[model samples]
Target: MNLALAAAALAGTPNDSHGESISQGVDSKHILVSQAQDWVAEDRQLQKSTIEVAPSDRRLIIPVCNTAFEFNYPFASSQKTLRAVCPSSGWQIFLGISVHQSDNALRYTGNFKAGHQLTGTDVELASLSSAIAGLAGDLRAIEGFSLASAVRAGDLVMQRQLVTPIEGYRLNRAVAAGEIVESSSIDSILIASATLSAGQTVTLEQLDGARAARDLAAGKVLSSYDIKKRHQVLITQSGIPRGHPVTRANIALQDYYGKLPNDSLQNYRSAEQMQAIRNLAAGTMLRLSDLTPIDIIRKGDNVQLSVRAGALEITVTMLALENARLEQRVLLLNPESGEEIQAIATAVGQARGLSTVAR
Candidate 1:
């Protein structure tokens, strides 16, 4: 590549007839001039900006953190996006044409606007300096992840993109120039689960995975409320009467029935069959295909209940005895015989009914 070629290409100034080149002096002065011109061209970075991205893109607005100074009182937020532009270099000084002619790199950087507040936050600041510094760092972080790709959609390009999981992940291990490695490890990740976080710790979440692992009951139909696994069921360690606070999902009544099959209640019709199950407890796992809802019914007995869309004979002990005095369970019995036919246990509702007398 001739050092003078670029000059000749741009300026078709007839080569001095005597072959005396226009670059009679490719000195520091000439290089400096070019450098100045380069700066001039890049002067209005915002104006001269060619969005190196898709023309029509919608950038994802991720809420990095919430700023609240007082407890229970959330800070009022008028969120404004901070934008970052890439200038790549600042004040540059091109010294002596090509260094092949004279080895010298005279590039200097002054002030560059990497980013700006598209919409700015008006935080009640105790200290302006701290806020400003924090904001600068945040701006840089935003800039660091602002990758512009020329994604073409038809004739126009859309420069918008979502912030992917590992978008700004920084790789650690160095591979020699020509190494063909299948994978690379990261030095660390930027963010982790809202519940977990550490500098270099990473959360390897499988997309659409269970928010957290738990027993998946066969008929458990999940809903939006269950989608967020914020409520952690903690069982008591005391090993007394199998009355530990069992971790049963608080499924919606509607969802519970919706999941049950049409013929679920039919399986538990007999008095003897229902009689065998007076010791039902809340948090008890029920599978109507194998479990009965209302156990034990005698002759002339009337089962009291309404069947809804999701009909299931779910046999369950009351969590606490029904209609109690001194928090104790009362017996639902045969008034004539004064014998306990049905028992409503207290606290952790479980069945404690007497055996049916033979006619």
Candidate 2:
């Protein structure tokens, strides 16, 4: 007789009528089913109510084992099939099972059109079975993604239906041609259009020292080709005559987007104590070679010559023999003694004697 049927008959037969005890033999089928249920609950971390075990056939019979039965999953590489083995008896049986887990997934709260960017209000978490939830991608990251196609209310948000937004910078206000592209004047934005790619966008660091190449409208997305590095070059605001001082009043620093000459002057301090070497028109870019150090002493000028010895000093008026700047050596002629002296030009009309010689 089948073990299942015999177990059922024994369960139905009264002990007094059969004059036999209920524990005469073990029910192998019941043991296998109980063991499979316990395995699913413990190993799979599934609730007993969520696990379903198929009923054993009443005609199927499994021999009772003298030792403990070992259990394993033998088919589909999953916990669906539970194989219970009677090691001592060399018999085993396969049982089928199903596990259902409840999970949360993101779904559209209302109908949305294509190209619509998902916001917090557009999606909500909804309870769903594992089989249905698996179809949806990560629920937490669906927000801020643009929809590739229209979606209806209560539809689950899926990875395939999303178009990642292209991140870039946009001008907060209109920028005129040749104006500096300041980081504070632009705002970061996301473009939801399918036609744009990430490579077409520009980053904030790329905008450093950048200027607009042309007139740009407000809220327009900026690209790498739309901006150029701003180069600073000194420009004359008014015509500077030759021998005139190159001061801040006449020359101003201007921003240039195009390439500048290698000799262009970049700082105002560099032009200190310098004079224009040639006539420069208004708005002309200043170059290093265009200016010369201002001469503190001019030829044929009378300069005070000072001679110093141990605890003694002598001052005399002499004629400068050559044009010289401060700290430059110049020859001076002594009118009374007809003597020549080499001295360093100290001021506009002053010189310090270095050595004396007879003419």
Best by lDDT: 2
Off by over 4 Å in 2: 1-185, 189-211, 215-225, 228-233, 247-249, 252-259, 311-313
TM-score of each: 0.18, 0.43
Clashing pairs in 2: none
lDDT of 2 by residue, 174-273 (tens): 9887788888889877766563555556677668878788899998778766787676889999999999888889989997766568889999988887
Query: Residues 153-245, candidate 1, lDDT per residue (tens digit)?
Result: 121111232122232223344333222211233333432122122332223231122231232232222222222222122221222122111
**Candidate 1 TM-score to native:** 0.18
Q: How many angstroms is residue 303 displaced in model 2 relative to the true structure, after the best TM-score fit?
A: 1.5
**Candidate 1 Cα misplacement greater than 4 A, ranges:** 1-142, 146-290, 293-342, 345-359
